[model samples]
Target: MSEKTGTFLVTHADEGSAVFRDVSDGQVHTMASNPDVAEQDVLEATIRPQPPMEVAWEVVEVAERREIELVDTDLSPTTQAMEIAAEQEVGDVERVERAGEGEVHVLSVPPETTEDAAADVLDDEGTIERAARLGAVRVEVRREEDDGVLNVRYLPD
Candidate 1:
């Protein structure tokens, strides 16, 4: 069988098996065995259908693997992000694509919970999954010190 090569994100992994999602496309691949990969990991790999059934895939070669870095910055949200936050209600989120690559996410939360919300975003696996989908290498989280606004910037290398 022919092999497919692309960037993939490890969407789920456990002791027995793992699931990968193509970054460029939304195709899903399931592997029968754990490939020493963890959830939220980004990988450049070649995969081929398993023999017989061909319902599952196997990683033939892995060219690269990486983890998205999450950073907590003391910097406040950008002017554009602040403006978007102002127009949103508490508990709302807005996503804006960057001019080049990646994305900027504006979140509005309670002023008293801004820090907690920021921390939650930084710790969420979905944040890394989003970065992988956007081909981003890092995520920078910025929060307003006294306001109810936060900016999560997914940056490309």
Candidate 2:
């Protein structure tokens, strides 16, 4: 989908949505905006056109949005690793910390845990799948395949 940004002049509100006039060309558009918007208040929003999930083309995310701004900041590598590791770790993940290059996360599980056992545990917990879908961190549950050892390597995203 593509994004469209504009100023909205609210005209009416109903059922958690709003009818607004796009100030750019005086065209009327209905979107899900703030219900409390005054009749003439102008609102900045980011809208994406969704191609007919069940109906015709529609716009969404019209409540509150602002122009994009870029900022510069430096965050600790360990902190970043920990956050991603935590998000991906299931109940068996005993420890998560930053490691050296090539593999950024070091995870410690129970002494008795094997790679297959860890994989089974993670499967039951379902957090690893979620982490994979989120794509926030790259990780592996085993260090060496032949050794049958369970470990986690965080691949930075």
| Per-model TM-score versus the true fold | 0.80, 0.30
The per-candidate count of clashes, in order, stands at 0, 1
lDDT of 2 by residue, 64-90 (tens): 522211111122224444455445544
Clashing pairs in 1: none
lDDT of 2 at 157: 44
Lowest summed-lDDT stretch of 10 residues in model 2?
A: 66-75
Q: Give the alpha carbon lDDT tens digit for every residue of 21-74 in model 1.
A: 987777899987879999888998999989999988889999989999999999
Model 1 misplaced regions, further than 4 Å: 1-6, 11-17, 23-28, 34-36
